[model samples]
Target: MNITAIKDKYERPILSLRITVTNRCNENCLYCHHDGMITSEDEMNADEIYRICKIAKNIGVQKIRLSGGEPLLRKDIVEIVNKIASLNFKDISITSNGTLLEKYAKDLKDAGLNRVNISLDTLNPETYKKITTKNLANSAKRGVLKAIEVGLYPVKINMVLMKGINENEVKDMFEFCKKNRIILQLIELMNSENCDDEKFSKEYHYNLDSISEKLLNICDDVKTRDFMQNRKKYFIDGGEIEIVKPIDNSDFCANCTRLRITPDGKIKPCLLRNDNLVELISYIRKNESDEKLKEIFIKGINKREPYTI
Candidate 1:
């Protein structure tokens, strides 16, 4: 496997691509960043996304994660997954709210998705309804279990800890993941300019540093990822727990290894700062050659900088 490496100014190779499939979502989660976007209607079709992924693979990107307000909201999501699967990336995954997974889990697995990360804040149905403004917690739970049964190895659960919200459910979530063989990731609430609830983010910003100690104490073994903003992984019982604390952390920025593509087809370099994005929707729509498109990918890589440092 001969892979071309794209390095940033800090020598961090761009190995993962988080593509925002669409801005449209089924639920209205209060803490949603919408992929650092305020509002958008522009969404790339399956063909456009395939071309982008091909260009990305040619430049040494090995991992691809499909994200959205809800990625499965796209009717042609199966086709999109099939197209990207043809690229032969080492890993392919999707992050969703999990409301629709039960319907599409088997199809997605057959289409070459390697894993899945479902966003679930709390186990309490009332709290879930309050946070997401939707009573789909039971539906989401069924989706997670179905994803596991359908062979989506390491069915990860992403839980964003909020002070007055789901912070108290950390231990409970860990136990749930262990019983169900899910990977529980504790994420810190992100404060992005794109977020509409600035006061809510400020009031509920609970750092993961304070909770990591408790996790470490309960875990049996520790594992680590060379990539990812949250690199620490603790093995507990039959499940795994990872901590993601990316807000205002120089260490996180220094270890970061990702490039983002918005639903509108712009190559975003950093999630925290939107100024350095390289517009590519026009070029993509113009049907530019792969060589030309590769230039834009490199340009996006060159624009990468340590947002915290």
Candidate 2:
């Protein structure tokens, strides 16, 4: 079936879907955005998720990523992975806190998960506890190693750089990724609609411009991912670092090709705004026809616009 890909009014094609499987998390990170979800209750089941993905697949979406407050919090995560894998997405990955990766990494890989992105903001146990209010830094480190051992290739570490918090640990984090042959993604702290704590954002939002400039000078090679908001990937000696500075970045919003699904099963058009969500679970629960669901998908896509622009 030659399905034509759908594009928003801005002419950006919807190529990837980021589904928040569960809003429940084990860590209380000081900078957590809760996956841009306003509410966390009443998460969709594996079957509903599969139906949503199927509709997405039929609409020419090729990639799928499972995310959450911490995706591993869900007990049926492996089952969810299996169902999504059955749709034959070009890629099946998850963004997790990594505390439970050691226990679920192999099972996830076996269930057709292609890769993983684990959040490890700091290597210092004390600092980790300070940021996350959890004493699981060592456990997360073990999970990182286990993910690599399980052949989850290109296991990426998502390090959200905060001004007075873990910003100074970027070099150390890069070294750690180099030692393990993993990719490091340095994400600038962002303020979302629900997490718009003015004082918190002002205190912790670190500008990534200087770090990006430093990487540009020392990087052996550089690559730009056009589909991913034109983010740059810097290749160092044996390590890889990707700089994600979405705050006030027009190009980032212009080139985005992602559609987010909230944990409660609403089609979230933009990560920064929640007002334009198109409900899906209610229709799915009503056993709506595929045509009806596709209309809902198109309605959501039509709502998509560059949040920064």
Candidate 3:
């Protein structure tokens, strides 16, 4: 197995990588950096994404995550997934908004997709509309059902808690996830990108303490796990909820293991600090060598600066 030493001090080995296949999306979630839409004219082609995935696999990256503004929007998404699975990766999963996922859930699972992370911020129809600025809850619900039926184990539900937005829907969302036997994660809104900055304020900021207290009311026992440095997972009423502080806060992120790949093949080492990205495929095609490709993957991992020295 190949391994690379990241820039951080001696710690755990880097093993997971998140690849964003497309900048395009079908919905406009109020909390995302790009309004859940494509801002760039250029996006990564299917082959280009696979190229990166292949290189990562050779270098002992056991887990691969497919993300995007919404990955399911790509017409050739299934092919991309098949190609990644062909690499024999230990895990292959996708993070989608669940609107377009309904149509492909079964196909994806059959094509080697191990699981899915569906971003459902609210369960209330009106709240859903307010958050996504669209009428698409039905599509999301259907996607969840289809994903489970297709055997997307640990079918995780990513719920973002927004103040004055949909905080009231937390319990209902938990019930929906629990009834469906899915993992429900509650995320604190992080004003990371430009669009998020535009809406950044105390009002938009929902504190974790208040959220934690309320979770205890319903959960038989409130428990948290410091999986990584700043990450803490809350288990309420036998439902899994994760609390993520804004990524921008330096102290909150220490176990910076997974790398983020934008839709256009830009490699982001850290989600909060939008810097130090290496273009792997375009450069690979120009020079084209396994050694060169592997080098890029190592460089991306080594650039970790969780606790910069």
Name the best candidate (by lDDT).
2
Query: In candidate 1, which residue pairs get closer than 3 Å at backbone N, Cα or C atoms, i.e. clash?
Result: none
In model 2, the Cα lDDT at residue 56 comes to 99
The better candidate by lDDT, 2 or 3, is 2
Q: Candidate 1, which ten residues in sequence have the lowest lDDT sum?
A: 193-202
C-alpha lDDT of candidate 2 relative to the true structure:
0.91
Weakest 10 consecutive residues, lDDT, candidate 2? Answer: 192-201
The all-Cα superposition gives candidate 1 an RMSD in Å to the true structure of 1.4
Clashing pairs in 2: none
lDDT by residue for model 2 over 1-309, one digit each (tens)? 656689999999999999998888898888777877876789999999999999999999999999988889888999999999998888999998899999999999999999999999999999999989999999999999999999998899999998888888998999999999999999988777666569667788888999999999999999998888789999999789998986478877888889999999999998878889999999999999999999999999999977753
Q: What lDDT does each candidate get?
A: 0.89, 0.91, 0.75
RMSD of each: 1.4, 1.2, 2.9
- C-alpha TM-scores of all predictions: 0.96, 0.97, 0.89
Backbone clash total for model 3 is: 1
The top-ranked prediction according to TM-score is 2
**Segments of candidate 1 deviating more than 4 angstroms:** 196-198
